[model samples]
Target: MARGDGLVAARHLVHYGYKPSVYYPKQGKNELYERLKTQLTNLNVPFVPDFTEALKSADLLVDAIFGFSFQKPLREPFPSIISQMEETRLPVLSVDAPSSWDIQEGPPKEGPGAKFMPGALISLTAPKPCVKWYRGQHFVGGRFLTRSIADKYNIDVPDYPGVDQFIEVGVDADEKL
Candidate 1:
């Protein structure tokens, strides 16, 4: 809950008229995070202590616990947290990648990281390799990606429609409802 992605998501929720009750178990040491936390605090967003309590009252959960940098074999609190999230069967819109999911392998075939599948995923720059295994609504956002950078990386960024900040992209036909 101390990640920048989570912090930014919280900030946007406030901007968009959503009242987010953050479950920040550990406070971040970074100044950017502190500032974001302070900003959210100033806006009267409640930082709730109990994760289950927060989930019970939540309409939707935005999981930003981990991103592309995540490694295998999740540690304490996280596994429990993810398990709790799965138990709720709540609709989750994971930012970047689902927490504990392998960037290449996607969710594991079994065990700790397998059961939880986000209803939707918002890929930051471009979709990751794990997206191949993801069977849900997908969106891409990165207006800041320069042309040269895209060309250099051979990233096939779709042409955005109008001035939209984000665009929904089609997943595999089999994945469609």
Candidate 2:
């Protein structure tokens, strides 16, 4: 997901009465950074380079830094960034799997104080095998659904079940078949 799009998404959520914040490290110039800045400006969502400040100001923090391809020990910037995020102590909502986590086997078994641990994980498309195999106690919610972008294209999407509750789908119809 584009950083800009994430900002827009946050703005939309807030517009509809939800409190969300974007968190990222203060890395130097990059294409992603430029795009994110532009998008944040367009959406009019406040952002802070410091994770501590962002966390203090937000009720829910969305982690959109890394995708599902991460499969290694978190290095300097990421580890430092994740460390700051963890210190925030707010409920985290990761975009895909938690950063620095192994998507295939789940997060590494380093110890209780690992950087990949998140409060909540929002899986896109399909739920990663690790999510089920590794019992993430911090996991509070998830969405394993897909959406159609066009007539010919369908993409796996993360679940964003809002605060409202309802029963829209029936489960017994297919059992009769």
lDDT of 1 by residue, 42-128 (tens): 989888888977888889888888778787777777888888866777788888888878887788777666887789998887888
lDDT of 1: 0.80
Q: Please give the CA lDDT of all the candidate structures.
A: 0.80, 0.53
Rate residue 67 of model 2 by lDDT: 53
- The residue-by-residue lDDT of candidate 2 on 63-112, one tens digit each, is 66665756476765677666665566777666556665666765566632
Reference-based TM-score of each model: 0.91, 0.60
What local lDDT does model 1 show for residue 109? 78
RMSD of 2: 6.9
Best by TM-score: 1
Residue 81's lDDT in candidate 2 = 66
- Candidate 1 residue 48 Cα shift, in angstroms, is 1.4
